[model samples]
Target: MSGLLALLDDVAAIAKVAAASVDDIAAAAAKAGTKAAGVVIDDAAVTPKYVHGFQADRELPIIWRIALGSLKNKLVVLLPGLLALDAFAPWAITPLLMLGGAYLCFEGAEKLVHMFAPHADHEIEADFDTRDPARLEEEKVAGAIKTDFILSAEIMTIALATIESPSFWMQAITLAVVGTFITVAVYGAVALIVKMDDLGLHMAATGHTSGSRALGRGLVRAMPRLMAVLSTVGTAAMLWVGGNIVIHGLDVTQLWAWPYKTIKYVATELANALPAAQGLVQWLVTAALDGVFGLILGVILIPIATRVVGPAIAAIWPGKST
Candidate 1:
């Protein structure tokens, strides 16, 4: 009887320890997910466009395919690579993060230019005009997956950096959680966004009440505007997050101290000025400064990327010019 009681106590202790580990992983994943919010937002925003012209029946399947590809990118390819980096070349993480940041800046800047300066939509038009629907779908899915791979790399790296776990297993579990959660969230949102118009149409057609019909009409009208807003928000987020990452990276490496200190000083001053909204004011000031810095850096990088890097990549890859 005494021996049985001792075994029960041991089992209870083990259960408590397991529960604690689960709580720790959950906490770490939540924190890491927050840190990668900007990239996640952009990911959700960008994915819907890939399914834009697909047939109504095919939309969900296409989204599912892309979501699966995204999962594979994060789990099979990126997670293992990240673990290897953490194990062997941990010091390389910051520089790689900076590189990803530069990419985000470039992407945001390019979108800005395309938005403000109207250019020929010939390429897009031509792509849409293709005779082979299957080929077009494949190409679109492939392109989207490629884009997702870059964003996933950024998200995973950011999450890994944010995790505070001492155990390798804990870090691995946290990353898996982050990756699965982000993938499902982003693509699930994309699936909904793409089907919203159809849902609205159905509601308008079949709703039993006038209010339901009116609400459906409103949803139909609102989706395009919502998409536009999302795109704008995503661009801003990318610039803000990218600039902040670069600034912090530079500060970490002792390459530049003034930008970080200057931003902090300004934010602190604003926070002090508005005691009632101190936190909000400080965040806005910091984000605004970071975005401004990002815009400037992105503008500077645009010419170099287009003239030098673009051409070099095209030269190497032949027929893959952006």
Candidate 2:
């Protein structure tokens, strides 16, 4: 039985190695996912508005559909593309990242403008309001999925850049995990946010106890305000992430280093000045500068986008673009 024991020992050794590899994968995935937090936050925040006015019965199903679409967007379309790009043309990633950053800044700034500034789109927002449940649901789902695709692309690209795997298979698996986890987390939260009102209403109507009814009423009242806060936080996150990416990209390329360097230096000086609360000061300073940079870049791009890229896209796509 010596040979049998040797064989068992060998098997045990192989299992140990396999376990190590799995642990490595998990560790890398967690770190990479953390690095992509801003895009992920923006994604989670943006998804809920799509199901805002849908009928209660249809909300979960709609989120499910969009979640599936998001999975397909990240895993099927983007994962392979990222791997291929890494394999063939690694240099394109920084530029593509900057492009995605610009889009995020534009989207975030547009939302800000829509909120505080009355404009053509805001007027249309009230004018073309649909009351039909079915039509409105379809339009909202379609729009949400389209927006999710852009955010998902950003998430995937950021994850791909952070992954330092030895093989494409490893990168693909990690990305798939990040994509699936993020999708479930975002949509699951969306579903809860959308349904908490109905749940609260039902509790108020049916609960036998006064305390339960009071809690339910509070929940119903709190949800809308919570959503508004979440949206504002999401916008800030987008600007912070986008501006940080652009500035970091510029630094990486050695193109325009002065502004970012100045920001970094000021942040460091502030941190040093306040030693007890150094970390908080540093973070706040960095975030503020990043957001301001994002706002300026977005403002500059808005004009160019409206006058130049918008026209070129319409010319190329003919009927598809507006």
Candidate 3:
């Protein structure tokens, strides 16, 4: 009986340790996931377009396909590459992170330009217009997956940077959690967003009560506006997150310090000025400054990306680029 009690105590201790590890993993995953919020939001916002114009019955399947592709991109392709970088070239992570930040800025800036000074990408439009339905669907899915790879790379790298774990296994597990969670959350949201109108329509048509029908009508009417809001939010988030990343990266590398220092100073002053709302004031000011810096950097990069980078990629990859 004494021996049995001792064994039970040992098992309980093991259970306690296992529970602690699970808690640690969850905490790390949550922190890392938040660091990649901009990419995740933009991902959710961008994916719906790939399913647009598809038959109603095909929408969920298409989203499922893209979601699977996104998962594969994150896990199969990016995860190992990132782990290798962490293991062998740890010093390169910051520079690569900043490069990802610059790409985010470029994307955000391009979207801003398109919103205000829209110009058709005749090649893209022509390609879509000329392709048969099946071919177009395939191409759209392919393009979306390609886009997801870049975004996934950014997400994974950001997650990696934020993870505090030094153990390789812990880092691996945390990244896997972040990747899987973000993929599900983003694509699941996309699925709901795309089908919302249909759901609204069905509710409106079949609801037994006037209030339910009215709510359904409201939902249908609200979708387009919701999408517009989502796009705007995603763009702003990209710029804010991207600029913040670059500023921090620059500070880390001792390449440029003033931008971050200046922002901190301003935020501190604002927080001091509004002590009652110190945290909010500081965060809003910091985010605003970061966003402005991002906008400026993005605008500057726009010409370089379009005039030089796009042309170079196009030369090498032909229709696969730009």
Candidate 4:
């Protein structure tokens, strides 16, 4: 009887250790996920554009395909690489992160420039409108997955960097959890955002009650403006996140702290001016500076990316250029 009791005690102890490990993973995952919020928001905001011209029925399926691709991008392609990096060359994380941040800056700044440039339409939509529907869908999904790869790399790196634990398996578990959660959240939100108008139209046309129909009509009317807002938010997020990374990287690389300090001063000034909106004002001031710096950096990078880096990449990859 005593031997059986001892065995039961050992089982209970093992269960407790398992529970503790699970709790640790959950905590780390949450921490890492929160740290990657900017990239996650940008991911969600950027995704809806891929399905824009598709038939309403095809939108969700396309998004599903893209989401699946995104999952594979992160898990199959990126996850293993990140783990390998962590195991072999953890020092490579920061520089790669900064490069990803620079790319975000370039993308966001390009959008802003297009908004003001007179010839924006010449290249903004590109040849997307000319392709066969199926081909276009496939291309767009591929493009989106490519884009997601960059963002996912940044997100995963950020998540990995934010993790405090020393155990490799624990870090792996946390990163996987973070990756799964963010992909679902981003694509799920993208699906909802892209379909809101159709849903509203359906509700307006087929709702059983007058109030329901009215609400549906309102949703349909609201969608365009909501999308515009999301685009603006996405751009801002990209610039803010990008600028923060470059500035932090600069500080890390022993360049200077003036940029960060200047932004902090501006944020403080803005906060002082708006007591009621102190937090918001501070955030906007910081974001605006970050965006401005990001734009400048992006402009500088544009010619290099287009004329130099782009061609070199095309040369290396041959058929893979976007």
Candidate 5:
């Protein structure tokens, strides 16, 4: 009887420790996820464009495909890749981050060019107009997943940095929890945002109350404009975030400090100018400067990417340049 009671005590103690570990993981994940909120927002903002022109019925399916790809990017690819990188070549993280940032800048600038010069369509846009629907959808999903991989890398890295130096298993668990929670939160929000128009249509059609129907009609009318605005915001966000990442990476790598320092100095001066709204002014100035730099870098890289890199990839991997 005494031995059984002792064994029961040991089991109870083990259960308590397990419960505590779960609580710790949850808290750590939340904190780490919060630190990556900017990238999370950018991820959500950037995704809607991938589903922009699809049929109403196809919209949710497209989003689901992209969401699944995003989950794979984070959990299957990034989680393991980042963990290995963190364990082995910690110094390489910043440069790789800068590479991802440059890609975002390139994508954002490409969109800007398309906006300004509709005659000069990108390969993807051309494919969309000319190719089979299935092919276009495949390309769109692939592109979205590629972009998500970059952003997810940043998010996971940020989360890893935010978490304190716990045990190896603890760190891994926290990162996994953070990655899963963020993936669900971000894509879930994206799903809702994309389906909003459909919801509005349903409400407009079926609502018994006149006010509810009227509100639904307003929602339906507003969706197109909202989507357009969201696309523009997404583009700007890509630039802002991409530039910010590169600048910080440059600072971290000790390659160039001037851009980050100059931006801070200028933002501080502007904040002083508008002391009443100093925080807001500072943030705006910093973001504007980052975006401008991102655009410049992207524009510079465009020709190099198109003329040199694209051809190199095409030569190596036949159908991939498009």
Candidate 6:
């Protein structure tokens, strides 16, 4: 009887330790995930567009496919690469992060330019090929997956950097958790956003109450505006996050400190002035400055990317430039 009681005590202790480890992983993942909010938001914002022009019935299936691709991106490809980096060349992480940041900035700035640029019929026509529906879907999914790979790389790198754990296994577990959680959260939101109109239509058609019908109508009306807002927010987030990464990378390299310090100083001043909203003021000031820096860097890179890099890639890859 005493032996049986001792075995039970040992089992109980082991279970407690397992539970504690699980909690630690959860906490670490949540913290790490928070650090990549900008990319995550942009991911959620950007994914819905791939479903555009597809049949309504295909939207969820397409999103599911993309989500699975995203999962594979994080788990199969990026996770192992990141672990290798962590094990062998941890120093490379920051530079890789900065590169990803520059990419985000460039992408955001390019979109901004296109938004304001005079419309060109050729550009529209170029994209309006009479491809088969299935082929077009495949192409769209492929493009989205490729884009997701870049964003996921940034997210995982950011999360890896934010993790405080010194244990290799702990870091791995935390990263896995962060990756899975983020993929699900992002694609789940995309699915919801894309289907919202349909949901609203159904609600409008079936609602017995006037208020429900009104709310349904409101959702339908609001979706376009909501999508626009999301796009704008996503652009801003890319700039802010990208700029932050570049500045921090520079700081890490001991190459530049003035930009970061100056931003901080100004934000501090604003915080002091608006004591009631100190945190908000500081955050806004910092984000604005970061975004400005990102915009400038992106603008500079735009010509180089389009004129130099684009042609170079086209030359190398022939017809596979995209």
lDDT of each: 0.85, 0.80, 0.86, 0.83, 0.88, 0.85
lDDT tens digits by residue: candidate 4, 1-322:
9999999999999999999999999999999999889778878877777777678899899989988988888888888889898889977767777887798788778778777784754543654554678777877888788778878988998898899999888988888899999999999889889899988999999999999999999999998788788878777777777887787777676678789888888899879989999999997788789888888898788778766787788899985542
A best-first ranking of the candidates according to their TM-score comes to 5, 4, 6, 2, 1, 3
Question: How many times do residue backbones clash in model 3?
Answer: 0
Residues forming the 10-long window of minimal summed lDDT in candidate 3: 117-126
Runs in model 5 lying further than 4 Å from the true structure:
121-124
Question: Which regions in candidate 3 have their CA more than 4 angstroms from the true location?
Answer: 1-23, 34-55, 120-147
Candidate whose TM-score is highest: 5
lDDT of 5 by residue, 45-122 (tens): 999988988888888898888888887888888878877888899888899999999998998998899799867845
Name the TM-score of candidate 5: 0.96
- Candidate closest to the true structure, highest lDDT: 5
Tell how far residue 49 is off in model 6, in angstroms. Answer: 3.6
Off by over 4 Å in 6: 1-13, 118-140
Q: How close is candidate 4 to the true structure, as a TM-score?
A: 0.89
| Structural RMSD, model 1 | 3.2
TM-score of each: 0.84, 0.85, 0.83, 0.89, 0.96, 0.88
Q: Write the per-residue lDDT of candidate 1 for residues 1-322, one digit (tens) a residue.
A: 9999999999999999999999999999999999999778878877777776678898998999999999999999999889999999988877887877777777677778878764634553465455888978987888778768878988999899898877889989999999999999999888888889889999999999999999899899998787777668767877887788788888888889899999999999989999999999998899889988888888889888877887899899985644
Question: Of 5 and 6, which scores higher on lDDT?
Answer: 5
User: Candidate 2, TM-score vs. the true structure?
Assistant: 0.85
Model 3 steric clash pairs: none
How many residue pairs clash per model? 0, 0, 0, 0, 0, 0
Error of 2 at 197 (Å): 1.2
